[model samples]
Target: MGFGAMNLAPVYGRVEESEAADTLLAALDAGFTFVDTADIYGRGSSEDLIGRMLEKRRDEFVLATKFGGNQDSHGILIPGMGRPDYVRRALDASLSRLRADHVDLYYLHRLDPTTPIEETAGVLGELVEAGKIGGYGLSEVSPSTLRRAHAVHPVTALQTEYSPFQRAPEEELIPACAELGVTFVAYSPLGRGLLGGTVRTAADLEEGDWRRGNPRFQGGNLERNVSLADRVATLAAEQGVTTAQLVLAWVIDRGALPIPGTRKAANARANAAAGDLTLDASVFRRLEDIVPRDAAAGAQGNESYLANLDK
Candidate 1:
């Protein structure tokens, strides 16, 4: 139910325009009508790719995109969301690149500590009035910040990193969303590919790859994490499915949609199929015992991640 463009472009590789177009078509064919992207991903390349691909079937999909953090009027880098002018200009540029009159879901990619949340919400609400966005959302926000934003407007969803390894959201954010009638969008539900047991060691990571810098996948932490994945694999074997399927099923079981990103068509199909894997109560209990909240081997992220999230 969650499809995003964060991993499709320059971060993974310089995707040829032709291949990129094919991927979008493949997604649509597979019933993934909701596509998410941020202005910062590939500095707008991902949105541009989506724009081109949707020319023929714009009515067939729900296009979701985000703005916030720093970017020029044209969506080039600046540094922070300092004022209302920044929000207006950023949305204008995103709309232009996406080649759409309005986005179905617009999100604040990060909370700008320097700017008052009220002021930010005011501008986003104005966009909804101007027919530039159909709905608004927040990412990585705390329960209090979510309340503040919701008071400003009806927040349709709250996007956060949620998984067995990252249980912080369940502590407060998930319940807050439920109370506020906001859909919970769980990003990185596969634990950055760890639950799949593909990244066996630090050597398996490519130099300069984003996963290398991730604390959960580093040093002895990687080995310890794999031990947990082995338990998942065992459960999957009993069910006659892949570990990835089991992990995804567990996330869906938790009442949140798991949005994982990958470049391979086979992987994408597998992920979508996991939405159908109904884990029995016994398997779910076994999973909770094997990878409880504290069993995760490393910090979800260091101070940098905390710095980026809403307080």
Candidate 2:
């Protein structure tokens, strides 16, 4: 299992440093062998925190980090930068922040429209050969883009959102990755806490919480999605598992490695236990009947962010 480090940062909400660190250690103790992070998450705070928490036990986990997003001085993600020179600088910066000589996997956080895929792949290949990163992957990219990059260098994985609420990847990305022999790494498999049956209304989110602006959580959409979540919760209750575990089990059964993020140690343990739950075909059919593909209320992200995703 993998642990997503995004929520450990203050990006989602105000996170206590001690609590976040404890949660990370708890995840490791719980048998999470892979830990994922990004440079833009919390404006580099995610990597810095992981560096501090895993400094002594770095070898215990397979570290995966991403680059390419350009952030301003204030930590706002502006756009993607995949130029050759930027690639080298970004990797060096990430290595320094991670306090590690190399990462198990390095991903391009987003496609840089300004740079050719071949050029980006070439640089990543060089990094792999130079022993800076073991493998390279891409996030939120299309099959065509993956093919183009793979032609230059093999892509180890494709990190994207994949949940009962977000099944867009199954239509193409998943099959493409399978055919290419590249692992499909799923992030946000819990639908950003929606499928967990915890967020019922806007009031549930803290001020400046990013999900507040998500279309799925706004207006009539929120009510509709919550109704769907309630149905899933009922099914989970019947199966004697948390709603999060049921959803994660479904994702894992679909052949994707899910990296669910949480801020609490209890939540981390709960998510880690999900890997052991085996959902029967009856449960899968029931879940499918409850949450059909593309049944979500809105797009996975807002317009500006959606624009960056490879079509």
Candidate 3:
């Protein structure tokens, strides 16, 4: 299993430093071999926390982190900054924060429109040659972009949102990755907790929570989504598993390594246990009928967020 460190960031909620460190350690103890993070997450707070907690156990896991988004003075992510110089600088900064000389996998968090993909790939290739990163991946990119980037340097993986609620990648990106022999690393396999059936309403979220602004969690969209999630919960109950476990099982069956983030040790243990819950073909068919593609109420995110995703 892979651990997503996004929840360790304050953007998700108010996570105490001690709790965050313990959470990472808990996940490691649970047999998670891969951990993914990004520089923009809490303006480097996530990486810093990982550095502090896992610096001594670095060899125990494959550490992966992303770069490319420039942050403002307030630590807000200013999207799209993938120039060659910026790429080098970003890797250096991430290495410093992670307290590691080299990361197992480095990702270009978003496609920088200002710079050519070939140029970005070339710099990452150079980094690989320089022994700074073991391999490089791309996030939220398209097949054409992957081909172009891979021409310069082979992409080890493609990170994107893939769950029962978000199946857009399956139509194109999944096939492309399979054809290119690239691993599809799925982030948010639980539909940002919706598929988990834990978030009942907007009030359930903590103050200043980022999900409050997500389209899927607002207005009529949220109401409809809750109903949809209830159906998954029902199925999970029938199978004697959690809604989150069922969702993670489905994502894994689809051939992607899912990185589900959680702050609680119980939730992490539950998520890891889902790796063994195999869904029968009949149940899988029933699941498809329950939550079909495009059944979700809103777009993956707001306009600005969706704009960054390669078409």
| Candidate topping lDDT | 2
Please tell me which model should have the higher TM-score, number 1 or number 3.
3
lDDT of each: 0.79, 0.91, 0.89
Worst 10 residues of 1 by lDDT: 69-78
* Predicted candidate 1 versus true structure: per-residue lDDT over 53-152, tens digit per residue: 7867889877888887444455343455735898888888998998888888888888887787887888888888888888888888889998998899
> Over the stretch 1-311, how does candidate 2's per-residue lDDT look in tens digits?
69999998886778999999999999999989999999988878999999988999998999999998764555344544888888889889998999999999999998888789999999999999999999999999999999999999999999999999999899999999999999999999999999976699988888878897789989899999999999999999999999999999998899999999999999899999999998798998899899998898987878766777888
RMSD of 1: 3.0
Q: What global local distance difference test value does model 2 have?
A: 0.91
Model 3, 228-256: lDDT tens per residue? 98998899899999999888888888899
TM-score for all models, in order of appearance: 0.92, 0.97, 0.96
Instruction: Give the Cα error of residue 21 in candidate 2, in Å.
Output: 0.6
Distance from true location, Cα of 149 in model 2, Å: 0.3
Count of steric clashes across candidates, in order: 0, 0, 0
Candidate 3 weakest lDDT stretch, 10 residues: 71-80
Clashing residue pairs in candidate 1 (N, C-alpha, C atoms within 3 angstroms):
none
